[model samples]
Target: MRVMAFDYGTKRIGIAVTDPLQIIATGLDNIHPNNIIEFIKKYLQTELVERFIVGEPKQMDNTPSQSAQHVKGFVNLLKKTFPEMPIEMVDERFTSKMASATIAQSGMNKKNRQNKELVDTISAVILLQSWMDRRLL
Candidate 1:
């Protein structure tokens, strides 16, 4: 079954998709947070997505951050919009940092690294991959 993952932010939401086997997650695109439900509707019509994995931002102390509230609101909207699809949340404390590290290691320039949307997309991909890996274990 295919899976879609989201890294939701106040201004933008990053999208990623997994293959039918649910083994790999690829960065898709960034969408405005307000347009996420519509984006999901459009994407679901084109792809056979079975589930959604959303990142839940947490503090270093493992407590949910303020951003988690927004994510929860987004999740609620998602559930209302797609009642049939399953939704799950994974801790995403360091996914952004990991994404930045990965990009840095790839030899991208400082200017490229500063692209917030690109970093958000990469973080979404990493979050999806982490979910897949956890399921495999």
Candidate 2:
């Protein structure tokens, strides 16, 4: 079974998907918030997604961040739209920073690395991979 992950934002939602064996996470796409559900539905036509791992943004002290409320609303919609699929939230405190660092170390061109969409996609991958690691432990 494959797992899907999302880094939700007001303007854009980053997506990532794991392999069927659930061992590797790959950045999929960064989509507009308004198109997320439709995009996922289209993706589902060809892929078998077993669960959703959404980033749970939290403050430094572990409180939900201001953006958490929006995420919660989105999760509710997701649950309603795909009732049979399980949804999980993983703390995403430093995934954005980690994604930036990973991109820098990858030798990607500065121009591309500066793109917010790329960072979002990488962040989703980081979130999903972190969850996958914890699940294995």
Candidate 3:
């Protein structure tokens, strides 16, 4: 079964999905916070999602970041909506920076690199890939 990942934010939620084999993670899209559930419902109509991996924001000192509270709330909502789907939280430190660097290295235009939605989508991909890598070990 495929897996899904999300980088939760107050305004926008970035989404990524794994292949049916749950191997490669691919950036999908960014949806408004108010539309995330509906977006997922529509996506689920076509894809069989086995689980969800959400990026849990953490500070460098290993404490939960201010945004972590928001993520927790989002996770609660996700659990309520998709009760049967397993949900996992993976620490997301420096993912935004990594995404920016990745975008730069990809030779994306300056405007595209500056797009927060793009960064968020890439961050979700990175988060999912990191979790998948750890599971393989």
Q: Which stretches of candidate 3 lie over 4 Å from their true place?
A: none
- Please list the C-alpha lDDT of all candidates, in the order they appear: 0.92, 0.96, 0.94
Q: Give the runs in model 1 whose Cα sits over 4 Å from its true position.
A: none
List, in order, the clash count of every candidate structure.
Answer: 0, 0, 0
How high is each candidate's TM-score? 0.96, 0.97, 0.98
Name the weakest run of 10 consecutive residues (lDDT summed) in model 2.
110-119
The regions of model 2 sitting more than 4 angstroms off are none
Residue clash pairs of candidate 3:
none
lDDT digits (tens) for residues 29-73 of candidate 2:
999989999999999999999999999999999999999999999
Predict model 3's lDDT versus the native: 0.94
Candidates ranked by lDDT: 2, 3, 1
lDDT by residue (tens digit), candidate 1, 1-137: 78999999999998999988887899999999878888888887788998999999999899999898999999999889889999999999899999999988989899998899999999999999999999988
Number of the candidate with higher lDDT, 2 or 3: 2
